[model samples]
Target: MRHTWRWFGPVDRVSVQDAAQAGALGIVSALHHIPTGDVWPVEEIAKRQAEIAAGGLHWDVVESIPVSESIKTQTGAWREHVANWQETLRRLSAVGIKTVCYNFMPVLDWTRTDLRWTARHGAKAMRFDRIDFVAFDIHLLERPAAPADYDPETRDRALQRFRAMSDERKLSLSRNVGAGLPGSADGYSLPQLRAHLETYAGIDRDRLKRHLFDFLSEVTPVAEEVGINICAHPDDPPWALLGLPRVLSTADDYADMLAAVDRPANGMTFCTGSLGALAANDLPAMVRQFGPRIHFVHLRNVRREEDRTPCSFYEDEHLEGDTDMVAVIAGLVAEEKRRKTEGRPDHQIPMRPDHGQEILDDLTRGAQPGYPAIGRLKGLAELRGIERALSHLTYGLS
Candidate 1:
């Protein structure tokens, strides 16, 4: 595996130097300054590359080129957005950055109810409190159909939870749930969120999935021609949210996606944290099954509050979460060996320590919500130790 760190560019509190110091040889990043649906000029790409290079780290993978909402819904300007996305891939390939990661989650990206939920060990980790999310959905957002999405007991629980909150807590919950991730392009106010939901009124799971397949059909050929691998990130939490459809939540979803586009360039970003949130996803089995098609990896873990779908989960310590980190890493290592034996050039997968708990000086550093420097450094160290031990024991490497 090629160890990397995610850097949110110049404005990010966690600098590229910090990533290098954390022992990452490659940087996974994106041109977040570029607006969605715009072509990424080679000049901007070169500049960011130069910036990372100056810190002694090469930009190895793009965390994303945001998939525009227009494209996801196949609505206004969607055709133009697809063309622009192809152009961006071409530009990235021209600059020797061939692996690109993007997600098709509508309206909002990965979300959490609490950005600073305290852990038992006195560290701060991000959490998605299930009842809190339900309360926000039904009581705060007041989506008319929100009640129908939950059971009667759950709706009652959410209502009670909402009633117990103070005004300040209510407002905080609304902000945390509505606002997208720090660098995402899809933050929304309540009215805006409602309007967005209205737009998806008739587009259920099947229709949304067809749109994704259509998108892959349009871009995968361009990707193959340009020698770029476009990997779709699995839906965070791996389920529907805010009444919107989620097609890429399960292993079968990925299998369908790959089959629909049946191209080498069409692939998946194996995000353990996102997929692991759903207890049903067997992390190691999925890795072994999709190894050939997985182009990037986010090796984080989450502890599900319940043993079912739509339950709350907190980002847990990488090795301590429900997912067996050792087994997953071993599968990935085995996949890399298989690729090597098959003479594939992309044998070594690029992986980063996804969302670490805030600990040590990280508590004061105030880095991006889930991207504390020292915490991720610790995660990377632990992951590296696991990979080394697995290699030595399973493959006889010293």
Candidate 2:
């Protein structure tokens, strides 16, 4: 694994130098200034790459070349938006960026009901308690058909949970879910977020899935020609939400994707945190299954409750949580070694610590819990040590 850190670029508080100091050899970044559905200029790519390289780090993967809502829904200007995406891929490839990570998650990206859920350990971790999400969906946001979306038991529990939350709790839950990506939707007011959720009402899971397949059909060929591997990120929670269908949440979902376009360029990001949120997904097994096509990895784990709603579990001492980090990384190592021997493309995959808790001194300051310096530094150090030991053990090298 090529260790990397996700940097939001120029404006990000965590500087490239900071990432390098943290022992990351590569920077996973993007041109966050460029709006969705627009072509990323080569000059802009060069500028950011130069900035990253200046900090003594290489730009490994584009955290995302964001797919606009228009493209995802195949709505107005979708053709133009997709054209811009392909052009961006071509430009990125021209600049020697070979691996591009993207996602098909609609509206909101990865969501958390509580951005600052206090762990039993006295540190704050991101959480997605079921009752909290259900409360927001059924009472506060009040999505039409939300009741039908939940099971009879969950529906009953949702009403009870809604009654328990104060107005402030409701606001926080809504804001946490609606808080968009860096170059994506800006922070939304309550009313605005309500409208945003409503926008996806007509585009159900099937529609979204078709749109994603169409997207791959269009841009993947360009990616193939440009020597870039286009890896689609999985849906965060890997389930339906507030009447919205999440298509990329299962192994079958990814199988559907690979079948849609038989190109090697169409790949998976292999985010264990996202896939591990669902108990049914065998994270390590999936890594082995998709080894040839995995271009990037978001290696982290989650504690999956029996009821199936997940919370950001503490950054498990490696190989903990639902994901078997050792088995997964060991499989990845074997795949990489095979690639090296067989002379295949995408031999060295880029991976990053997906999310870490706010611990140690970081818990005192109010930084984003997952991006806390100390916690992530600890995680990176552990993962690096694991990779090193695995390499030595497997390849018979010191």
CA lDDT, candidate 2, residue 17:
87
Consecutive 10-residue window with the lowest summed lDDT within model 1: 389-398
Clashing pairs in 2: none
lDDT of each: 0.91, 0.80
Q: After superposition, which runs of candidate 1 have C-alpha atoms over 4 Å from their true positions? A: 393-398
TM-score, predicted candidate 1 vs. hidden true structure: 0.97
Write candidate 1's Cα lDDT for 1-398 as tens digits.
Answer: 99999998888889999999998989999988788888888899999999999989999999898888888888999999999999998989988997999999988788899998999789999999999999999988999989999999988999899999999999888888887756665578889899988888788899999999999999999999999889999998789998888999999999999999998889999999999998888999999899999999999999998876799899999998799998899899899999999999999999999989999999998888899999999999999998888778556442
Tens digits of per-residue lDDT for model 2, 1-398: 88998887776666788888889999889887788889998888999999999989998899788898888777789899999999998888887898999888777788778787787578777777787787787787777777777779878887888888888888788888777774444566668767767667689788888889889999999999989999989998888766667989989999999989989989999988888888788877897788888889888878775644443233443345778888788888888898888898668889998777778877775554467667677788888877888889555332
User: Model 1: how far is 285 from its true place, Å?
Assistant: 0.7
How far off is residue 274 in model 2, in Å? 0.4
